[model samples]
Target chain A: MTINEIQDQIIEEFAQFGDWMERYEYLIDLGRSLGPFDERHKTPEYLIEGCQSKVWLYPSFEEGIITFTADSDALITRGIVALLVRVFSGRTPAEIVDARIYFIEKIGLRENLSPTRSNGLLAMMKQMRLYALAYKTKQEHS
Target chain B: MKLAKSIEEIRSDFPILSTKAYGKPLVYLDNGATTQKPLQVIKLLEELYRTTNANVHRGVHYLSDMVSERYEAARETVRAFINAGAREEIIFTAGTTASINAVAFSFGERYVREGDEIVISGMEHHANIVPWQMLCERKKAKLKVIPFSDAGVLDLEAYRSLLSERTRIVAVTHVSNVLGTINPVKEIVAEAHRHGIPVLIDGAQGIQHGMVDVTDFDCDFYVFSGHKVYGPNGIGVLYGKAEVLNELPPYQGGGDMVANVTFEKTTYNVLPFKFEAGTTNFTGAIGLAAALDYISLLGREAVTEREQALLARATTGLSAIEGLRIYGTAPQKVSLISFLPGAIHQYDAGMILDKMGIAVRTGTHCAQPLMGRYGITGNIRASIAFYNTEDEVDALVKGVRKVTEMFA
Candidate 1:
């Protein structure tokens, strides 16, 4: 599915919840179900900066596609990472670089993306885009 | 003063206490970040801007003269509030950060030298830490840290040992913003003074919680922000001994800070005016004085008593929760509580609590070194004011229980 399609699906899923508690519960569940992150990739080199909570995001480029694995100490932020990774991973560099994200606002998680919030979801998104851009640039050069 | 108002009446004074978040009544426990302003302060600000708006100490107009008098009166109010020796000692700056920066730069220029040492405690907020570090880097001085124990008590023995003949100045916080530990500032001051070294007490967290007398403490410098003490923002007080302040160079050079100015040379103004550069925050100073007046009417002792009760209740209730661990168990603490709810992440708990109409501060609370000591990145802090009630404390405890259950 396209990025917009996935975002629409997320918004629809969030719309089923009546209150913030219910929505956050779903996110927490999603956070708990994320794939295991490698311990070696938990170093400072893979750590996303500017977050009050620690988030380590590791990206790998292979066969013209880039895959991302991430983890956060905070469950809500981890849930956010889980969502982003699900949407962006297993996609080519060009797709990720060109993807437009609009679900966070629709799902009422726009605060996590605010510059004032120390959750670093915004930073994580930016880092993901930067990685995709770098891969795209390198591929074109080669 | 008048008989202290009941908590209900006092809560009424602050309009924000009535505010709701996410369709629930707000439980504001983030007083450490900044206290909510009372109608007394808010109305005073509005009244000043509406009727008495003027540039102080510069114009010959009626408004300017009136405002200048009120501004100086505000300084007198601050002096009386902190019980400083003289009104000339209160230098108004932007906030506590600015006040500390002013001292660091001016004091560094005047006193700090190559290979000199500046001692600070581990529990200091970033506002107190970074300024000295900048000063050290500029002067090639060394920054010495006094370590604290698991209970968040500063080791005065270590502090005494750290102070040497080459120690330039000792700076420490009167209260830890994150840990809520009230340091023994009087003894700390005496210890530094015994070594003939001056001490700078960061009173940003201390001033609001209890009475602070610079004369009684005998500290050379004490600093605080207005907004944290139920006053206006953009205004803070740096109370310095006249003898010590006079020896230091001015931090900034601008309009009101000079006695005489020429292209060739300019002499600085006297005492407080020498430190206050450019057009001062006259309006904010006036509002801060009004806030002080409001607190006086409420009665400081009563406020402290009520807040202590809230703190005790919170501690007891939160301690009862299984798997919950509270940090900063120093016997002497203020109303604030920082904790980790079992294996639940602080951000996760804070987010859940925020959605439940509880406003808590989550993160390092700008005391990274203290966090490092505890071996945790951050925790959830719920700092209370006198306006906060037992019901709010109960709500917070209940909220944390819910967070742990949800995560479980």
Candidate 2:
């Protein structure tokens, strides 16, 4: 499926929520469902600094698709990154680079993200695509 | 309770309270960060642009005189607001950061020397900490911190021992932004004075919570931000005693701050103007006066009663929750309550609260050292104001409970 289609599906799923409480409960559930990040890879190199909470994102290129791994100690931030990961993971480098990730705002959740964490979300997306761009360059050369 | 009754009516003067966030009523508890401007201040901003718009101090034009009159009048309002000794003592700057930076630069140059020590408390916003750090580095001086108790009160004994002939100036916050602990600035000032060292009180969070009588408080300098006090963002007050201000060299040299400018030799302008420098935010200054007037009408005692009552409500409600630890347990606090719920990251709770239309501050509250001292990275701070109601406090307590529940 296209990135836009996946994002659209997520937005539609979010729109079903009647209120913020239920929506956050859903996000928290999604966060808990994320398998524990391998501790070895949770190094300073993968960490995104300046977030209101600590976030670690690890990425690798496999079969020309970007495989992104991420975690945050804070559940809400973990949930927020989960939203990003769902949108961008398993995509080809070129596809990841071009995806707008507008589903956050489209679902009205972007407005609800606290100012500092919102920055962290943007940083998380930016890093994912940067990884994608690097993989795209590697594929182009090799 | 009487104050709360009147405050419900007072809340209407602020237009944002009537607005909604998502589907819920906006529960604004971030007044420590910035205040919602009253309609009086907002209208004054509009009126200034509509009618009283001109460059101040330079032009002999009628509009200039009128603009200058209002700008100076605003300075007088600030002077009265903080009970500053003289009109000349109140220097306008961009905000509390600017106000502190001016003193740090000018005062540091004049007094701070190599091997000299500048003492600040553990609980200071970066605004108070960074500028002094800069000055210390530039002057090859040492920076010292006065420790605070676990309950968030400054250790007065530690402070007394820290003072010495090497101590040039003592800078401390009158209130902790994170803990909401109101320090004994009067006592701090007295100690600094005893050592013949000058004290600068960072009143950025101080003035809004209660009456500040600079004459009685007798600090060498007092500083506060305008936005935190329901005024415009671009304006702040730096209240220095006339003699102390005269001792420090002018902070920035520019058009208005100079009496005469010759390439070879230039003389600076007088007291307040000497610090003002370039084109000031005259509109912001007018709005600040209007905000002060709004506060004055409500009366400081009433505001205090309402804010304290709300804090008590919030503290009680949140304490009922299991595994919640509040920071800054000083006997005298105002306007703010910050806590860390068990096993929940402050960001987790804060984001959930935001989603529910309950605005609270998360993270370090700009007091990183204090956070480090407490062995935590951040906290959820829900600071109330006179405009806030007990119902909103309940919303916060309920929201926090839900946050813990979802995370658990």
Candidate 3:
């Protein structure tokens, strides 16, 4: 699926929640159910330091498509990362780089996505895009 | 149990208390970061900007004279609030961080030499830690730390050993911003004085909790921010000993800091003016006076008692939560609690609480060394003021329990 389609799907899923508590509970569940990340990828190279939480994002490009995996200490942050990974992963570097993410706002998680929130979501988003841009540059060079 | 005024009256004074957050009544417990200003302080700031808007100390006009008089009077007000010797000792700066930097630069230039030592406590905020660290780096001096226990009590024995003839100065917090430990600052001051070392007490957390008599403590410097003490932001006090401050050179060379400036040489101003270089925060200073007056009318002793009760109530309520670990279990503490609910991340807990219209601080609280000591990234801090009530404490406790259950 395209990034926007997946984002719309996620928004639709979140719209089912009755309240902030329910939304958070679903997020926590998502966090708990995240696929096991490679332990070796958890290093300073992949670390994104947020004032409130720590996030680690690792990306791999293969056959013109990029896959992303990330983790955070905070459950809610982990859930948010899970959402980003879902939307951006399994897409071409060009597609990932050019995609505009509006799911966070639609899901009423805009507060958490603020740069000043320092939960690493905004930083993670920027880092993800940077990774895609680098890979795209490398692809162009080849 | 008698208060100067009822909690209802005190809450009414702060207009923000009635405000809502996320459709819920705002339960603000971030007083350690900064207190909500009373209507008097807010109104005074507005009035100053409206009518008394003029540059202090230099203007020859009527507005300037009026503002200058009020600004000087504010200095007197601050001097009396901390029970300092005279108004000359009280120098206003941007805030606590700026005040500490001024001391670090000026004091380090005069007293510190190569291979000297400066002492600070482990739990000091970055404001207290970084300035001294910079001073130490510049002078090629060593920075010694006084460690605290698991209970967050400062080890004075270690502090005593840390001081020596090579020790240029000792800087410590009167109260730990994160730990809420009210260190025995009087004893700390005495110990530093025994070795002829001047002490600077970071009173950012201390001055708001209770009465701070600088002469009684006999510390060479007492620094605090106006915003933290229910006053306006962008203004802070650096209360130095008149004799000690007289010896140190000015931190900055600007308009007000010098008596006369020539292309050849510049003669510096005396005492407080020497430290205050540029156009000072006169409006903030006046607003701070209003805040101090508000506190005075409320009565310091009364505020202390009321806060103590709130702290007790909060401590009791928070202690009951399963698997919640409260850091800084000091016997002597102010109305603040830093804790982690079970294994939950502080950010997650804080975010959830914030959604419930409860404001709290969830980070290192600018005490990374202390966080290092605790072996954690950060924790959630709910710091209370007198305006906070048992209902608010109960709400926090309920919120924590809810967070814990959901995480489970």
Give Cα-based local distance difference scores for all models.
0.92, 0.88, 0.93
Model 3 lDDT tens row, B119-154: 999999999999898998899999999999999999
Looking at candidate 3 chain A, the ten consecutive residues that score lowest on lDDT are A112-121
Q: Candidate 2 clashing pairs?
A: none
Model 2 error, position B279 (Å): 2.0
Which should have the higher TM-score, number 2 or number 3?
3
Instruction: Kindly give the stretch of ten consecutive residues in candidate 1 chain B with the minimal lDDT sum.
Output: B1-10
The C-alpha local distance difference test score for the whole of candidate 3 amounts to 0.93
Worst lDDT 10-window in candidate 2 chain B: B1-10
What DockQ does each listed candidate score? 0.81, 0.72, 0.95
Candidate 1 wrong stretches, greater than 4 Å: B1-3
lDDT string for model 1 (B112-192, tens) is 999999999999999999999999999999999999999899998898899999998999999999889999999999998
Per-residue CA lDDT of model 2 for A6-124, tens digit only, reads: 89999999999987777878888887887678899888899886548777999877888887888988776677788788878898999998887788888777753445454366677
Top candidate by lDDT: 3
Instruction: Please report the candidate that would top DockQ against the real structure.
Output: 3
Segments in model 3 whose C-alpha atoms lie over 4 Å from true places: none
CAPRI docking class of candidate 1: high
Off by over 4 Å in 2: A1-16, A62-65, A98-102, A112-119, B1-5
